[model samples]
Target: MQSIQIETEYVTLGQFLKMIDVIGSGGLAKWYLEEYQVYVNGEIEQRRGRKLKPGDQIEIPDVGKFEIIE
Candidate 1:
């Protein structure tokens, strides 16, 4: 897996959506979440505010893996 650095100490699921430009805007994160297309460590993650710590792995079907790093 590859790693992506976060400028902050930690981040949330919504922050990730914004970070990667996964959606056109922040509001799109909510809409995408409703589609249930986001995953963490291979399992579907439904919480928008789920705390993402260093070493966490997030998987988006078309986007591949995004492993968190300092």
Candidate 2:
């Protein structure tokens, strides 16, 4: 797993995806979220606006895992 640092108190799923270079834009992130599988701390997640804060973990199949830090 890798770690990503965020400056805000929280980051939305779509924003995080783009920040990590997983997707080019929020639109692509939305489309990717709908077309692919994503998980938050081990549970399936589909919401683009899902709040991700420090200590949160996001996993994208075939891509990798990311741990959030502030």
Candidate 3:
């Protein structure tokens, strides 16, 4: 899994996507979420506002796996 370092207590899914270059802009988060399946902590997640903290795991098929770190 790829490690994503976060400087804050948590980051929103939309923000994370941008941090990883998954989306070019925050505005694309909604469209991306609707078009793809994002798994968070082993559960399907669709909310762009979902808060993700350190140790959280995120999986996107074809995109790869990632883990949040402090």
Residue-pair clashes per prediction, in order, are 0, 0, 0
Clashes of 3: 0
Which candidate, 2 or 3, has the higher TM-score?
3
Candidate 3 C-alpha error for residue 16, in Å:
0.5
- Model 2, residue 20: distance off in Å is 1.1
Candidate 2, pairs of clashing residues: none
- Candidate 2 residue 33 C-alpha distance from true site, Å: 0.9
lDDT of 1 by residue, 20-46 (tens): 888777667778888858889878998
Better of 1 and 2 by TM-score: 2
Best-to-worst ranking by TM-score:
3, 2, 1
Candidate 3 Cα outliers beyond 4 Å, as residue runs? none
How far residue 44's Cα lies from its native spot in candidate 3, in Å, is 0.8
lDDT, candidate 2, equals: 0.93
| Candidate 1, superposed: residue stretches over 4 Å from native | none
Who wins the TM-score comparison?
3
Cα lDDT, all candidates: 0.85, 0.93, 0.98
Top-lDDT structure, candidate number: 3
User: Least accurate stretch of 10 residues (summed lDDT) in model 2?
Assistant: 25-34
